[model samples]
Target: MQKVTFKIRRFDGEKSWLQEYQFPYHPGKTILWALSYIKDSIDPTLTFTASCRHAVCGACAVRVNGQATLACETLLDKMLDRWKTDTLLIEPLQNFEVIRDLVVDWEAKVERLAEVKPWLIPRDEFSKETGCRQTPEDFKKINKNSDCILCGCCASECNKLSSNDRDFLGECLRFCVSGK
Candidate 1:
């Protein structure tokens, strides 16, 4: 395709609308790059959050065609191929308050997470001075859970949260505290 089109859902605190933008398509470009290109070259008013472009930081997570994915790691070509279209619908993650165009508010989520007491209470064997050391096997058990970057993807895709957000803590926070 010569060009790719993006229909992005934009919110400015009170009002919400869909804004369309098109740009020349390039091979091996990621969704994050496309967002950056639009913001930098096309529309300076566009708002989104991204950091640690390596995908370790989940700040770049967004709903691409109704599914939550890390924008930095998702290739535009892959999305185009998967959907068999040149146009993509981008929206803020579901089950969160939208702060701006594509940015969601984390303040409430953080507050809810704190209610779970996600931290561990140290045993008498482990103290601040000596520090706690765990065996490789112990670390391995919680390794996968520790990888959660709080990107809100799991929460966004969670059916339970969509239905009853007040009761459900969402998968990400559950997994995070479960590991601890």
Candidate 2:
């Protein structure tokens, strides 16, 4: 295809709309690259969040055609092939308050996490100066769950949380604290 089109859902705090943008297509480009190109070359007002371009940071997570995926890790060609289309619909993640285009409010999520107190309480023997030490085997048990970057991808895909987030915390938070 000579060009790729993005139907991006935009929110201006008070209003929401879908805007379409088309740009020259390049091989091996990622969803994040398209967003950056649109923002830098076409519309300066477009907004999104991304950091640590690698998948380690979850800041770039967004809903691509109704599914949550990390923008940085998803390739445009792969998505096009999967959907068999040159157009893609990009929107903010579900089960969260939208602050703006592709930006969701994380303040409440952080507050919920804080309420659970997801931290290790060292034994009395382990003082503040020395710190608590864990064996390699002990650390390995929770290593995978601890890798959660709170990108809200799991929450977006979760049926329970999507139905009622106020009553249920996302799996990310649950797994993150379960290790503690």
Candidate 3:
């Protein structure tokens, strides 16, 4: 087994700091697995969000080597191979307030989505059994947009929102709004 070093930016409300962790490299392991190992074995106080480990849920989003991505979707071997280093740097997503280590507040996005009326409001009255109907062609129009898991990756990478500016509605919300 090889040794890998992970440098993580940790936040605890009042302040934030960088913390280093060491892990035994295993082929084909994802970044999420390494993070889990760190939290479970190395530091019990560490915190992050993860759900639907298969990537369907967007809860495990974090910045890896300065790129916004999902931890579960990022393979450790691939990242090391691509970056040509045994060290990985992880931090909370950009344009968000960190609530804790690697966990950012999603309330802003939720609020924006609420403002946009993200779901369809049927004009015509319909029964519970009749449900809303849509043609195949109509369904296809929003199919791609519907794939968004609201992971905030697009928002984190957006040029419109830097650390200084975060009042703008993110791409994820725009996509969801358009899908309606």
TM-score of 2: 0.92
RMSD of each: 2.1, 2.2, 2.4
How would you encode candidate 3's per-residue C-alpha lDDT over 68-161 as one tens digit per residue? 8899989999899999999999999998878999999988778877877866676586568888788899788777777778888888887777
Error of 2 at 174 (Å): 5.6
Positional deviation of 148 in candidate 2, in angstroms?
0.9
CA lDDT, candidate 3, residue 161: 72
Ordered by lDDT, highest first, the candidates read: 1, 2, 3
Question: Tens digit of lDDT per residue, candidate 1, span 1-180?
Answer: 899999999998899999999999999999999999999999999999999999888899999999999999999999999999999999999999899999999998898888887666567899778898788997887777677788989889878888888767655754944545
**Tens digits of per-residue lDDT for model 2 on 92-161?**
9998889999999988888888887766667778977878888999898767667777788877887888
Q: In model 3, how large is the Cα lDDT of residue 114?
A: 84
Q: Give the worst 10-residue stretch by lDDT in candidate 3.
A: 171-180
Scored against the true structure, residue 147 in model 3 reaches a CA lDDT of: 76
Whichever of 1 and 2 has more lDDT, that candidate is 1
- The whole-model C-alpha lDDT of candidate 1 against the native structure comes to 0.90
TM-scores for all predictions = 0.92, 0.92, 0.91
Quantify all predictions' global Cα lDDT against the true fold: 0.90, 0.89, 0.86
